[model samples]
Target: MRVFFSTLALCLTASFAQAQCGGSFSGFVNGLKDEAASRGHDRQSVDQFFGSVRQDPKVIAADRRQGVFQLPFTDFARRLISSGRINTGKSKARQYDAVFDRIEREFGVSRGVLLAFWAFETDYGSFQGDFNTLNALVTLSHDCRRPELFRPQIFAALKLFENGDFDPRRTTGAWAGEIGMVQMLPQDILDNGVDGDGDGHVSLKTSAPDALMSGGKMLQHLGWRAGEPWLQEVSVPDNLDWSQTGLRTTKPAAEWAAKGVTPRHGQIAGTLPASLILPQGRKGPAFLAYPNFRVYFEWNQSFTYVLTAAYFANRLEGGPVFDAGNPEQGLSGEQMKRLQQKLSQRGYDVGEIDGILGAGTRAAVQDVQQQLGLPADAWPTPALLNAL
Candidate 1:
């Protein structure tokens, strides 16, 4: 009787677990169907789209485990702009020289810059992701964390299907619904997709020319300057004021020159409106980011990503590597979390306590550094943590 009761309890637990999974996902899908239909999507199309869509726990897990934002700029940039990646980018550039020339002539964006974005986004299309686009988008839309952002993407995916641009059965991409060689979102595809190969259909996934041209078009639409340097590596003087070393403060090249900042390689003649960005802090490396650098922010909001993409583009053009001034080690995730908590306790709004030192957190750190009469580099250091 005891064994029979134990077996009965195990069976009940399994049945309950199965029921919970099926019921919760089914309800979420029904709600998504209603929402999509209300947003002017065809009811039949919405039903067909959501009918076979299963809840992807893997997508949710991937979203929660995004660690790239937590890494220091030096580490992140070094990994992405390695010697191997630079060689591959150059090879791709030479392989598609004619296509890039045409794209550059039409869009006025650099071929190397486009190649950098492609390499960074999906490793030159070698691994564009394998998650089903529809399932991923629908699952993300059902999630409560950022439903507003993902819902529109789901509608965009549906519209792509309606317009005969995407076949749902073969459409696979990143976990967040980004598709194609350059990992463009659904709305981006609809807005900036171009038929570079001129086959009458803009298939960015299979056509290299189409993806490259579409990326160029997207950058052009994002206000990429015709002929402007994105950023230049520079050496900052030791006696320079530490307060003037962030993206928030813009000064002319003449002003920086007056303060003893010089380009590492070339010359800074004109008074271009540029900002001094110390990526890893005052001790790491300094860069004079020009107006065109903002275009990279539009491509990706992460400062590390934008800087790495720009740096990689420059490397492809035979630019020199960064000056080695960064520290041997940076803060770990737990240390960063502790620093953020301390900042919050002192009334500095560091945004989330997620250990990722973003703009808000950096600004708060700068404030603390200023209060403590230290160099306001805005970078979290072990000494800074101890001071806090």
Candidate 2:
């Protein structure tokens, strides 16, 4: 009888979870609470953690409207890497000089890199975000569209709550459930969080040292190489093979130098394999993306954002402002979506026809350009679309 009852209970719980995934919002949250109890969390704590987690429709709206990523690289970078942001980053670097020094020594991550993320993520902790974190996480978890990506985060947040580090009702952050100054997700905090201020508690939201150091540790955990360059501005010769541009193709720095890919300022790692990325096109700002640049993708998957952050880090390290050349105008959002559809029809995996020039879309554009005898700079144009 005991064995039969246990089997029946398991089947019922499984069915309940399945129903919750796409059913009413209240049912979904109940499923989460039940699952927490099953996972060894005490019922009282689980109830406390989720008692007030109202679903945030605004988070769902923000998740669906990531249209800002469609902006051209020059415009995006220019908007993000403002002079004031740079000045503030430099000031923070000085203010937290000792913390940064310790971070570099312990984690093998750069201060410039951490400072750029700090400035960009929350403007040196001036604003971490305003959304109720528990609500956002619960909402996103209940959302069927990418539930797998967000569902686990709710449990991680619960662990923080259990530790007295999180307040379900009061803890606020980004709409995506990222908490603290660097905008880290809950799992990141659980896995890589550091208490840099020597204060037994890891106060990432209120302590600059904790935030910066924790950010550094997270980067290191993401496979950041010690003291190695991530991005370098470069001058690609007019005669250089445009087909070899884009991150899909990598060549030794020396091979690129032999082809007249000169560094605009700092020394290039001679033997290190690097990809030549023309963010706008061959005519626009060019950069050599080093091995460390790949790790930025682990932080944020958007190619444009990772590039801008890396470039800003370089600027913080005293690199010159990029010379934005006059590249041809790219496709509008709808046009780009149409282009993606065409590419998909042609058997190229452009990920989604969302109108964003993501890495997959760019790669598809490059392949089509090369096939059609175009410049193959990976910057989609109306000409290419018309040709398709």
Candidate 3:
């Protein structure tokens, strides 16, 4: 109720923004008319459609909030792995083993990553959000902060309506107007929604298969590699170029071996390019990642998220817990960046030497630590800096 009232108030204030320009309703009706003529839609239905879409401010605010988010990786990981999410992920993973296996086999993306996303985005679709997508986008588009960015989405929603794809009054979605189970935005619905229930129409909402498959398709489109693990737990030796094993770029397994780094499991079986990643200061789990890990990066660029996702996936696979007992001392963001900068000066690329300790920076730090004959946890410290 609060959301609805807030939306109404925003529209009342902003009515002048559009009502003055021959009115929002008139413009909407006109656009529908063009769409109707193009697709042979009747005039009355078009008018009805135009009347149905109202501006939604709550959703706009929601989108605005999500757009500028920055949470530390550790914090993000802990939040996603809440007890509720873990149990839910486990249950869903077992229940959908067939679908997951097929998707895994075909896409090379593990079911755990898929499941984790489902858990995160909408809590296994329980909190898919509630809002009228068209209204929100249309309202936001007219809000003036960035109309050019949202106007097309509103238009797209209208196109969907005018085409009889979904009734405007009945179609609802997330606060930012993400539809159906996967909470896909309107553009994604247009491009990737599928008729998972054997219905002629494709929808992101109301169909579990449709939503999950749409998400899977997005993963595949994002460069998911088949037949490769996203990550692997590795034994970072007491001394090695551990930092160079970052996903910022590639290094061959043999190159890593030359630095005295060995996998906890054994020597890597092939010449696959891998990156070193240490998520928890030097005291925590270290990972060897393949190209597929980059795919996880594509979905959401958080070293913490990808690492935890991989760990959760490992749990799903019955893999052992990380043998590294504790996190090495953590580096402050400033100290970490300086460490990264030093590594870059020494010919290791840690990606911009940013204060953020992303996988690239960690790998660069590892390389320096190994060269210095220090334990290569990739968690740089003042002591390490003092030696430099």
Candidate 4:
């Protein structure tokens, strides 16, 4: 009877998901329009908001092709941070010196962090993407993968439309429906948008000052400490405990110091809490991630991407390049999937077995390594897979 009920529950869940996700596209759109009107949005405004909305297959394609995220931190960071991008970031910082200064003063967000994001997201507004904003949002909302997250943004976009800020026929941006220079969603703009140029409108796309200030405000809203460091490159002793590494474990800076964790440069706060992150394992580059570093995850969830962006922010502030030490090669996508399967079978919740070395998978690997008396460095290897 228990097995029968579980099967029935599974069937019900599949049916419910189908009802919410894979139905008629026109009906899904019409339901959205009805919701807007019900929420007291003007009929004309609602009609105009979704007028040109059409499913963009390209957006869906872009969403699925995020395989670049599967790459190791070293390779991914190398692809993103370049001398040319760094130079351009410096130039932009100087050009908008006054704006950045004001942003730092008002929002307590440093120019280096915002500049790194601006450089990476749209290359200093060189390309903010060319997809239709409304189409992208509506299409993603109608799709099954992440409707709950995207559906509300459609309404937020409508609010922007009502305020004369967004255009369904135009307003191109990232395929994820984020707009303007820093690539923010409509909801984020509504909540944290700023008029840094004093133009009475929060125009993030065309206005550099507005984008920088708005991005700064958003970071502050995401729990950025007023005057604290985020990422700092550090050196760890060879005999340091491997299980103590990873983001899950944190110790006071003094405690880490006691463990022979030395800053590659300046001193870390003695009392401040920090996590020793061995992104490519203990053999590779290491960083002491502070409280402010957690905010980067709120910005972007990819572990490697967040680390790279934070490190780039440090670089913009004159931080030195990292030393890429020799590390063992990690498991490929298939091997990772197999490892995740084994971990899950042993009662570890490794989130989707998508073959990405995410935090969950890393934690599970560390636990299994400890059990097998192996180095719990959190870097998956072929030997670990064989042991499993």
Among all candidates shown, the one with the greatest lDDT = 4
Q: Write the per-residue lDDT of candidate 2 for residues 129-218, one digit (tens) a residue.
A: 999989987887788875666677788899999988899999998888888998888778888889898888888899888888888888
What is the C-alpha lDDT profile of model 1 across 139-199, one tens digit per residue? 7667776455566666677888888887666798888778889888778888889999999
Q: After superposition, how far is residue 233 of candidate 3 from its true place, in Å?
A: 2.6
Candidate 3 lDDT, tens digit per residue, 41-70? 566766777676776657666755531113
Tens-digit per-residue lDDT, 113-134, candidate 4: 9999898889999999899989
The per-model lDDT (C-alpha) reads 0.79, 0.85, 0.62, 0.86
List per-candidate RMSD values in Å.
10.0, 7.0, 8.5, 6.3
- Order of models, best lDDT first: 4, 2, 1, 3
Candidate 1 residue-pair clash tally: 0
When 3 and 4 are scored with TM-score, the better candidate is 4
lDDT of 4: 0.86
lDDT of 1 at 242: 79
> Which residue pairs clash within candidate 4?
none
How well does candidate 2 match the true structure in TM-score terms?
Answer: 0.94
Which runs in model 2 stand beyond 4 Å of their true positions?
A: 1-20
lDDT of 3: 0.62
- TM-score (all chains, Cα) for each model: 0.90, 0.94, 0.67, 0.94
Model 3 scores a TM of: 0.67
